[model samples]
Target: MKSTTSALLNRIEFPVLLAGLLIAAGLWGFVELMELARAATPHAFDTEILLAFRHAGQPDNPIGPLWLQGAMRDITSLGSTSVLVLVTTATIIYLLLIRRPAAALLMFVAVAGGKVLSILLKFEVDRPRPELVSHLVNETSLSFPSGHAMLSAITYLTLGSLAARFLPDRTTRIFVLGLAVLTTVLVGISRVYLGVHWPSDVLAGWCAGFAWAMLCWLAARLLQRRKVLADSE
Candidate 1:
């Protein structure tokens, strides 16, 4: 039993272990948020957090300066469908040009899968946008999970992880990954600040997005190990 346990532990690398943990945590959090989203009433924390972004008794006016609101609009655009599609297309083209068809294919699958998953979850919960505050930007989609937040996490993190593989050193890889995470986080926060999503919606988006990205990474890793997908040259 001791020897078998030791062998099992030895077979699990840090990356695999970390990805497994993240998948578990993300799925758990997403499920909890989904339950809250299905409730007839908004969760207390969701309303409280959404309200915190707006001026007291003035849901129409956000708490920040006018310029800050503009800045948030710009930041939030980084997670928009248009921007994400452009970035993903450009990355895929670059990968293809560099003779990394395997990586390009994986990238497409990861982002496209995330997009579909986001849409399904949105419809599944069928939650409406927060009416507690005025939306700084108009959004017509169902709002259980913010598409911007989920897609941003998927695209940026996938791109970041792929970039890290080719980076020369650990520090550079860490920096790229950190930037991806920061961007994802900022996008999620912007959703709440703009009054387009409840805090739980953004949180759920992040959870689902992170899990999907990590699942793709694991799939790619497995394919590479099996020689089904070529590693970066």
Candidate 2:
């Protein structure tokens, strides 16, 4: 039995196994957050996290210094639609220029599809933006799941995974992926700090975004293995 189990594990590619686990965990987490989002009473978890960003006595004042607030705004912009689109376009162009049209097309579809999915989710949930605290930036969209958080995860993770394929060193690939996750997490946190979204919204965004990105990665992997997509640059 032990040998059989070991052989079964060895038969699965490590990357595929990791991606499968992430997808399953993400889907489970998203469902849990959905329940929270639909509840009439706001969950205590959301309120506590939302208030943590504010100053002790002043709800209007964020916890960080003035410069920190400015820095956060800049960090948050990394997840904005304009910035992400520009990055995706530039990346696709670079990939094409390097004679990797297949990789470039994959990049385009992954990010673009993620955008459509985010929009669909926003309408499906029809949850309103948080009014518990003042919004630091202007926003007038349904907010059961944060668009910024989700898109940032999708964009950064997809880009990072693609970049990893071209890198030769194992450590370098891990670093690239870690940076992608870090950027995604920071963007999600910034949305809550800005008071534009509840904590649950960001959680749901992360869950959905991660699952979608992994699925895309897995699909691309399968295609490459089948000679339908480019194996490398």
Clashing pairs in 1: none
By summed lDDT, the worst window of 10 consecutive residues in model 1 runs over: 224-233
TM-score against truth, every candidate: 0.98, 0.94
lDDT string for model 1 (14-43, tens) is: 999999999999999999999999999988
lDDT of 1 at 108: 99
Choose the strongest candidate by lDDT. Answer: 1
| TM-score result, candidate 2 | 0.94
Local accuracy of candidate 2 as per-residue lDDT tens digits, 1-233? 99999999999998899999999999999989989999988899998899899977677889978988888899899999999999999999999999888878878888899899999989988889888888898999899789899999999999999899899999999999999999999999999999999999999999999999999989988888898988456
Question: What is the C-alpha local distance difference test score of each model?
Answer: 0.94, 0.91
Hey, what RMSD does candidate 2 come out at?
A: 1.7
Instruction: Name the top TM-score candidate.
Output: 1
